[model samples]
Target chain A: MDTPDTLRYTRSHEWATDPADGVVTVGITDFAQDQLGDVVFVELPKVGTKVKAGQAIAVIESVKTASDIYAPLDGEIVAVNEVLNGEPEAINAGPYEGGWLFRIEPTDPSAWNGLLEASAYEAVAQEG
Target chain B: MQRTPLYERHRDLGARLVDFAGWDMPIQYESGINQEHLAVRQDAGVFDVSHMGELRVRGAEAMAFLRYTTLNDVGRLRVGRGHYSMLPNESGGLVDDLYVYRDADDDFLVVANAGNVDTVLDALTAHAADFAVEIVDESDRWGLLALQGPAAAVRLERVAGMELTSLRKNATRDVDIGGLHVRVARTGYTGEDGFELFTAWDDTPAVWDLLIEDGALPCGLGARDTLRLEAGFPLYGHELTSTTNPLCTPFAWVVKDKPFFGRDAMWGAPCDQRLVGLKVTGRGIPRQGYTVLDADGTSVGMVTSGTLSPLTRESIAMAWIDSSLARDGTDLAVVVRAQAVPATVTTPPFYTP
Candidate 1:
């Protein structure tokens, strides 16, 4: 429900913002946070690690269950959110903005075309 | 769907509703399970557990009838005492785990889980037909609330007008609370000192308000499950199922020496898998049904119940492991998701007072 039009999303619920510096900001969508209640622990990839699109790169743990965060686009992690390691509940509070998981530098700049727009992603997420 | 008297109250509190077994229940409140769990550990918390069913057996053969139904001996229960036991089928499988309270001469009360209410009632009804006892299903007419944690005693004393030290562990007594006659038992599943209040349907709302005013926070099923799991209590469905015996779980100590159902079948039987606790050493959350392995990656067991322990700030799981690999200090691997995470076999309960 907290989808920002400026951001692009994937069917798996990761949101990425194309920040003009070639480094896209990435985090789990608000819908993902709501489904996995009360995030207690977060495991993010280290900085400078490379990952392919659709690969599971991080782990988000909640009191009820744990889920994998897939890479929305192929990129190299430039920076990781250190705050989430200690206070994972930030995802439950402000998942779209302050709860950003990591920053990525995409290998192919045009790979963003595969991502879904806000309206398109919402329809897919609402199916079930 | 089955609805308890507190269903409307939970909805009024902005609870996340879910269908649990046939009942429309609250899984969490507006404050969430983490906040409610902390409140119970530090202060006081109350849960609307009216969904759990209760059966009353009263007659000259009440004791005899109960002795033939459960695996534990009813003859050992004195007046005003309660004992935790399980009903086992003829094949040595658990029918349901329940708490039996001795109310009076030729009278007893049995409290069973919410989902197993009908199953337990049907079993008891069929068995009682051969005896001189009358079995009454009082679940629909009563409301049960569990007031747990350190401040629980203080909160209940304000309404009961009596010190709670008299109601020791596993003790039950009839008390007048706010002009309403209720049965108060000193028992809980959260590993905290608390009292379970059983009152008439109409008196539940008033009693709930009184407890809230006395500093008892309202919690839901989420906190109840996490708290009980932290206390290392075994749930009926997850730990003790129709195919799982009580002796295989960590509750073998409660299995008494008695001539009851499934006694002859399970006598001197050996269990293939034993329930033990596992603490994940790697950065992965172990979930139920995940396979556990040894250092060589050979499969040893599978996780039965797992969760993030709020009190310990660690990932812990209860699993049924091979007897040879179920010893304490044994290093194991829990296959979480797709990767295997390093885990250590530890003694249950993951946390102790």
Candidate 2:
């Protein structure tokens, strides 16, 4: 339930943070992973693919059901977490750290403005 | 929604509740499905299966009536024994899969699926005009609990104050637990050494508490589904449906050579498709309703039940496909999210303790 203030979130429960340079690291929120139960498979978009904001760029499948992971902002996919192919449970163990799905180089830096901050995202989580 | 007697206990234990067959039941407890599944496989786990339906038949022609109504030869069953059976419709399709127990020469008990209780009762009543038999719906009068695992007998023996050495598989006996009379049956869906306890509805909570206090982990329906899938057991709506013929599945042993309601139709049934087990050899988790394709990329079947088995850590599924292509080691593909994943036909179960 910890919504780190350093990251921005979306209504769809995805999180993005600029870990270094102009690249933003993207992953699902802890609340999202918890609701998904045990993660079994993750399908990530290929690198160099252009994605629009709010577009489904990844798929996270649990033992119970499958869910789509949306891109928070329009960007080109630069890299994806290859470790997820073998061990998707990292998302359940540490959604904020090792479970980052992909890296995106933003087309518009102002796209972050449209995303919700930690405080605002917490309200959405509560309402859900 | 209908609530079981242990609804309060489930809420207090922080179980995730969901609507199952019109009953408000726990889908998973606080520990989650994976842990609960492993608990049942390694140790002992208890399940609240009170949602299942119970029917009692008692009359001068009870044995004859049951033999003519069900797929199994009920006349072969002795007192204190039971076998898995099904109520087949006139067209060879299943009405419901059940376990019939012969309690005595003139008495019998039928345990049915929760969703098809009313349908099964109506069918049985409609067929009872010729025979002098009384079919009574006793679902609300009893509470059912299943204790499953390798250590189930040892754990239950401590709390129930009875020796379980005499009870073999599919055996039933009456025992006393904490001064309460209960019927214990050595049968379970998880393919483990286990026992199911049937007691008065009002006394279920106390017996459940006793089993938990004796080190039985309280499991939920989520784990139950996974466990049964791993065991390759056929569920009512998933594997055995109104259009599914039992003769075409791995459970054909339940059908006897004697006369029954659907015996004539089943003999003439066109069994073009047969149920087969698939082990995913490629990426993607195959699920129910997913398309099964042949090597030529032609649609041949559909998945009935599937899961990522916790024991094997491999994706496995059951599908109904062309009987000619249902052999072991047959190459196939499953369309998961529009991606064709490589799979191979294998005979279930996926795991064995």
Candidate 3:
């Protein structure tokens, strides 16, 4: 429910933030974590892997169900969140800050312009 | 979707509602499944099991009729006591796993799975033509609430204003709680000391509110599943399906030595597969429909139910495997998400109270 104004979100409920030069931090939105209660395992893609926009690069397994986390834009995975391997509950506790999934170096940084803004993403979250 | 009497309470409590067997029921509360599960293990948690079906059988031939239809020895159930039993299909498989409570000399109450109620009722009706028993569906008339945990008895006793030390396990008693007529039974699916309260549909909300005020945590089906699986209780759809025989599982004791509907077929049934427990020795959670493999990685069977036990903090599962490989400590692997995770064959009941 907390969609920060500085971040861009996708229809699939993932959020991307441009926090540094050419690198975009990616994590599932607060809405996604709430819907998928009590995450037990997070399968992240390896570093240096090339991923296309909308491609499923990771899996989030909760106690009740399992779901895929899609890449927000065409990019190369620069770093993965190894902390989630041991403590996946961080996603439930702090989905926006401590629960960031991975970082990617976008092939085209302008792809962020095409994603939904925080206010627009709020509409999608509300429609659900 | 059908709603229980406590549906509004669940909504107000911020429970996550899910469709279960055509009923809109709470799957988890705000505290989450793991927390709710531990609450039942360490303290008291109450569940709105109103979705469960209740059937009443009463007549001169009630005992005889039940004996012919069910797999257990109904004759052994004295008044005020109950026993776990199953309705066997003609092919030696199960119709449903249920609890038969002897309420009176000629009356019995059967608590059945919510999803299998109609099927079980039809089965009983078809089998009752030869007997003089009358089968009445009382599911709509009663709402069941299961208050389970180590502290369940103490908490329930305080609210009911009664002494529960004399109530034996698997026994039922009619009592008045806050001027509401209630039937308290010392039986539950979770392997814990607890009581299941059956009250009239209209009185359920009041009873639930009173118990919540008495410090009972509201639990949902999600925790109910983890608790039962940790206790190694077989679920009806997963472990005792119409195609799965009970003789091949640890529940064979329910099939007594006496003759029953499927006695002849089950006498020498070829039970090549046996239900066994698996403790994950490696990474990944074993889930239902996952393939079970042997040392050579050859497919042998499939997992029926699996979960990471909150109490033990270990991943455990129940699976059906080749009888030859069902021995304790037999090396096996489960295919979880296309990876072969090492596991070992162990006895069920991963947790004890």
Q: Report the number of the highest-TM-score candidate.
A: 3
Cα lDDT tens digits for candidate 2, A49-84: 999998987899988888998989888999999999
How are the candidates ranked when ordered by TM-score, highest leading?
3, 2, 1
| Candidate 1 lDDT by residue in tens digits, B22-58 | 8898888878889888888888899989889999988
- For residues A3-104, write the lDDT of model 1, one tens digit per residue: 888889999999998756798989988888877778998989999899999999999988877788998888899999999988899999999877899999
In candidate 3, position B192 carries an lDDT of 93
Each candidate's DockQ score against the native complex?
0.61, 0.66, 0.70
Candidate order by lDDT, decreasing, is 3, 2, 1
The C-alpha TM-scores of every prediction are: 0.92, 0.96, 0.98
In candidate 1, which residue pairs get closer than 3 Å at backbone N, Cα or C atoms, i.e. clash?
none
DockQ metric, candidate 1: 0.61
Give the DockQ-based CAPRI class for model 1. Answer: medium
Q: Residue-wise lDDT of candidate 3 within B1-353, one digit each (tens)?
A: 99999999999999999999999999999999989999999999999999999999999999999999998988999999999999999888889999999999889999999999999999999989999999999999999999999999899889999898579999999888889999999989889999999999999999999999999999999999989998989999898899778889999888888878877777679889999999999977888889999999899999999887777768899999999999999999999888899999989889898
Error of 3 at A110 (Å): 1.1
Clashes of 2: 0
Best first by DockQ, ranked: 3, 2, 1
Clashing pairs in 2: none
lDDT of 2 by residue, B173-241 (tens): 999999998999999999888999998999999999999999899999988999999998999999999
Please name the candidate that would achieve the greatest DockQ relative to the true structure.
3
